[model samples]
Target: MTETAATNEQISATLVLPYLNHAVRMYEQKYASRADIDAAMRFGCGYPKGPLTVLDELGLDTVHDQLAARYAETGDNLHKPADLLTALVGEGRTGKSDGRGFYTYANGEVIADDETPSADDQPQLRHDIKKVGVVGTGTMASGIVQVFAQAGYDVVFVGRGEDKIAGVIGGITKGLDKLIEKGRSDEATKEAVLGRLTGATTREALADVDIVVEAIAEDLDLKLELFRDFDRIIKQGAILATTTSSLPITQLADATSRPESVIGMHFFNPATVMKLVEVVTAPATGADVNETTLALCAKVGKVAVSCADRSGFIVNALLFPYLNDACLLAESGVELSVIDDAIKAEAGFPMGPFQLLDVVGNDVSLAIQKELFAEFKEPGFAPAASLEKVVADGHLGRKTKKGFHDYS
Candidate 1:
């Protein structure tokens, strides 16, 4: 049947009306699955979910009316609706109700299956972790200590000296206090978290912990020595994990007799805030070790992705190349602000390369770039001579307050 002039006129009011209407029609006609429709919407338009899902959440008539208004204004083909959406709107068969329109709703409510796990299903892993041990007194170590302590696990924070251990504990306490002040946590929670931490001045303090995470200075030899010592001290069957970002997990595993127990649990910077935890598995790492590490990440409210024991792993492997490219741009003597502005505007980056370098610390970026260049020997990964010069000048980003831009 041909559409009425009124229907055609109504189509002129919406911007994305035609696209959404087409999707609805296709879905109703059983042309594709809801998953495919959702995928198309998310990937095609960058909407968080499909039109149908959005309709269900926003109420169908609301979206339909909004589209109709946009169509009235634009008079573009994009505003026209597919036959399916027209029919559903005409019949008042909006989604999440009346058993119609992309999805069925029971008793005027969106039906949710309790038996099956949904996309957001986060199944908790039962970790029998009573005590946790962490080696290192730097930012990463303090963050690790916070994670365990907050989870009600007794944490043994180890450092080479009493002063370092004291500093780590102090940092952890300050972090917890910040959380409480921000209302993200309560005073009682802060107390409990602080009560769980025990700073140790030696490796022997890790003996009783169920899991030991090495977060020491990123020196391969130093890490290997620490792992060997941990092998002799930590209880057998206990999980041995590392927070090395670039080092190979297999080489670290070789430092211990029980290589099967060793794995890399690389936490991103400002570990307490970043959600990603790359669970690096070595050739010698046992299946149980992998599972336990994944479980531990979940316990700490992190999303873990398992990867092979390669330098830089997934995110960094992709991330650093882009960063290196940015450095190259800066090396061309493009004003720092110009380079930053162009990339931020054109590429939609959150921060310009130089700005991000400052935030990440120039020294850290130089070290990582050196490691990447050594491994790949690619021109793209080459450390920008400009960056090296800046670091040598002691302009080590935000920490030094004088990197790409002067903080002072």
Candidate 2:
């Protein structure tokens, strides 16, 4: 291979190897199924291939060696090769090349033999959730409102002001109109969806709502405050869910009288478009509440993956660390553009880490990293200093037109 190709491979390994390793560990722990784990990254994060599949393609032996080398170099436990990977290698089931690894293969293609439970086999949904309340009028909130309204639920959204409420409604209308122009929807459908939506400026409007989804800012104080209010104002046995990506769901639940009803319904941005909803369950989350949330996600045509209420949950837990490792690689003298190109070309990721960081915002990335570091207390999980410097300098990302790379 050429010099450039070698660097590309090195950078790609530096970033993705740990994630692939963690995916193996996650599978071993039974946090999620092989299928759900793969789907979470594929559909949820838009990864070209899930970590296990990537491990298969990269060859278990190859990954093991790379991870072992990385572990020796960094002395990071996360870099240590997963026991499952080592076992597979020892058994001589390297990867697709040898027709085995994390999955069975035929003719260099993965065969379908998933033994995991199907998404179709879900518990009965709660019958009381005819009316849904969504708090916040930002992009995520508006998309969620449209999702519930379109799904034939009576959606009541709360905003701080009439202008924000109207703005969310207008945005949803414009989106529906765009769909009409694309011939994917009709006037009647648009009107019916819009007719199902109601907006209010007070928390009192949500008192009668069967389920309230909080999509406000990602501040713990704000979410705890909202949860307290939700506990007081919402009816008995109603679900109080937050869309927080980084905060501890258990703490959020502790703030509410009905901890069993408090759960994390973490929807991806552009809720109408993303197919994944992580139905995170706190220790106090009721089994029925978990079932209801899963059933509701299926109702809205999303693939819901259930996980324990941990800091980053699934996607962010695995993703930001890789991105942070990429930052470290850049700080060690690799050109940002070169690292980006190598990742795209070698790993077939949707975008390079830098590109994704810019779109996601470096400040947000740093915040999530901090949360992860705080939760796991892993030295390797610490936020990259380079990432912190960029955020501190106010080069947030696309929002600020500057980050690892300049948008301007």
Top-TM-score structure, candidate number: 2
Model 2, position 73: C-alpha lDDT score: 86
Q: What is the alpha-carbon lDDT of model 1 when measured against the actual structure?
A: 0.70
TM-scores of all candidate predictions against the true structure: 0.68, 0.94
Cα misplacement distance, residue 364 of candidate 1 (Å): 1.9
Question: Model 2, stretches more than 4 Å misplaced?
Answer: 1-6, 91-93, 96-100, 104-114, 118-120
lDDT for 106 (candidate 2): 91
Local accuracy by lDDT, each model: 0.70, 0.89
Where does candidate 1 have its weakest 10-residue lDDT segment?
Answer: 6-15
How many backbone clashes does every candidate have?
8, 0
Off by over 4 Å in 1: 1-127
Clashing pairs in 2: none
